[model samples]
Target: MWSTEDVARDAARRQGRGLSTAQVAEKVAEAARREQETRRQLDAPTETEIGPFATDPEHLAQLWAAKHTEWRRIAALLKTSGEQAYDPDRDAQGVTWAQERHARRQGALDRHAAWMRERQDARDELRTQIWLPADTSRRLRAIAARAGLQPEQVITQLADHVRMDEDGAVVVAPFTPHRVEGS
Candidate 1:
């Protein structure tokens, strides 16, 4: 995090050259401008058009697997090199840390899977409800307007509030109690 001014002052002191405050400031400004230009050049994209497969998922997965394999190979080499290495007893603490990290990842994956299933179920239910033989699409649209939501949103809400059992059947019932007749 050294600033351009710090670098310029250190340079002047090392050179045994006395620079006025204004001269030092000017030097720092010039260095900063050059650094900005260098960053801009580095960040500029290439003019050549890139192919879509440059970031394909299968390629990325292969790259990640190769990277991990190489890292493990390097670690094994370092262990065998007789260089001062970490004590196995001290590093045994890593097992608990790794287990905790793995458990967290499993929980996240499970939650994501459940969410995906719920979304798919909601979509199926929405399609069925909206396409019922007794009702037209316009009636479904009116219901959606009454609920202050898009038709899809209303359908998802209903599906989430209702779910089928493992026996491949759903029991339909009113979700909320109706007001008494005289109320």
Candidate 2:
């Protein structure tokens, strides 16, 4: 058996040169960050709306509490059902590795599915993506700061002039002025 650092060191040796220990750790951390970002991007909905729009804050908090309760219930179930509570290996026993991790992931997914069904009708918000050139983004940020507004707020105000449909397509007509209600 070998530690992760040992495996990383061996991998460095096979690459024809040894990387510094810090370099190896940095690489591992970078890989973890990339994986996390990938998961977030993949799970995120394509269209979303930011709120404080129509619903009452107290109602939103109650809904959030319900979701939290679901999570806690799921966690308790998972804790009870997961790998026998303790391990005999390595003498300093705790959670087992590998196979149990897969089990945990599957359990979480199942729980999430159930929770989603429970809260399906309670979902809110819409999301949209924006692409801007690097220089343009910098200018926009500066302008936003000057106006004491976030870049997104600035964009929201400007969006009022453009005629866009629910499908996010822009109408090829003359500009119009209107307040774009939050979804």
Candidate 3:
């Protein structure tokens, strides 16, 4: 992982002129500032941008599929060009590199699809919401930590032990805490 300073130093060295420590530091700072500005420009949304489509699964899928097709077309073209200039000795490593790159790209798309499916599934699942006092929430978290369970899981399990009394009061059975190995 090369830092801005390393890149600046390398560029200066290539120019065949030795720079003082202060000059090298100044160059590194200038390079870093420019890099940051470029990143900001890239991250900012464009005026011609389409819908955000974050909550629209079908539209997001279509976008992803289109991008995947474009990547596949580019990869195929590169492969065709490489084959046209074949050199067994020189391209043995190139073949391995190309295969690895293709696999990585495919894996990224596969992972994205899996994540989209998870988001869709989550939307379909039933859920309940309740508000608890800040102190009670903290206590629940502590209990969950001691039991090696998530706070939500602790609450779900507690629901099984809750009952209603004749006087319309809620009563809960004694909770049996799970013993953690180190605790």
Candidate 4:
């Protein structure tokens, strides 16, 4: 694989070609514009079909169960690794690789925690904005209780169905419909 230094050298060589300074600057600007445009396109939301918003308590429950199972699996793996047994005296002064690995793991955990907190906050906010009937809310809460999730999870999942597409057109998610007959 080409190293960063190699890449820089290649770029310098390309710049040192017969092209004038103004030409090089123009080429760089054009490349930057193309990169920005590509990123914008990638970030843009695609068109989606809108349908009724229906929240399946069973599905939510299954999802929660799966997440719990995955978490347990991860915990088991960590336990087997013996790394979970912390040792304060584990010196990293001579173990640069281990120190780097530990730093990466810590960074990943920190990022995961931050993402989880942000997701929880967003779910809470979404729940407050949901305008489901009292009976529906009650049913949802009941389902959530059975599925090991908070009522807010049901509300947030349903809320996700009510969103606009890139063109500002209302696009409802198929799974979470606006109304369920007996919900």
Q: Largest lDDT belongs to which candidate? A: 3
TM-score of 2: 0.23
Better-scoring candidate (TM-score), 3 or 4: 3
Q: Which segments of candidate 1 are over 4 A away from where they belong?
A: 1-48, 55-101, 120-183
TM-score list, all predictions: 0.26, 0.23, 0.28, 0.22
What is the Cα-based lDDT of residue 8 in candidate 4? 33
Q: lDDT of model 3 at residue 20?
A: 36
Cα misplacement distance, residue 146 of candidate 1 (Å): 26
Question: Model 4 misses residue 68 by how many Å?
Answer: 67
**Best first by TM-score, ranked:** 3, 1, 2, 4
lDDT of 4 by residue, 21-55 (tens): 34444544554554455445446734544357843
Better of 1 and 2 by TM-score: 1
lDDT of each: 0.48, 0.49, 0.55, 0.50
Write model 3 residue lDDT over 32-147, tens digit each, in one string: 55445544544664565457753333433343343333333333433555443223233343345445655766898899999999999999875899899999999999999988
Provide the lowest-lDDT 10-residue window in model 1. Answer: 1-10
Candidate 2 local Cα displacement, residue 70, angstroms? 35
Candidate 3 residue pairs that clash: none
By lDDT: ranked, best first: 3, 4, 2, 1
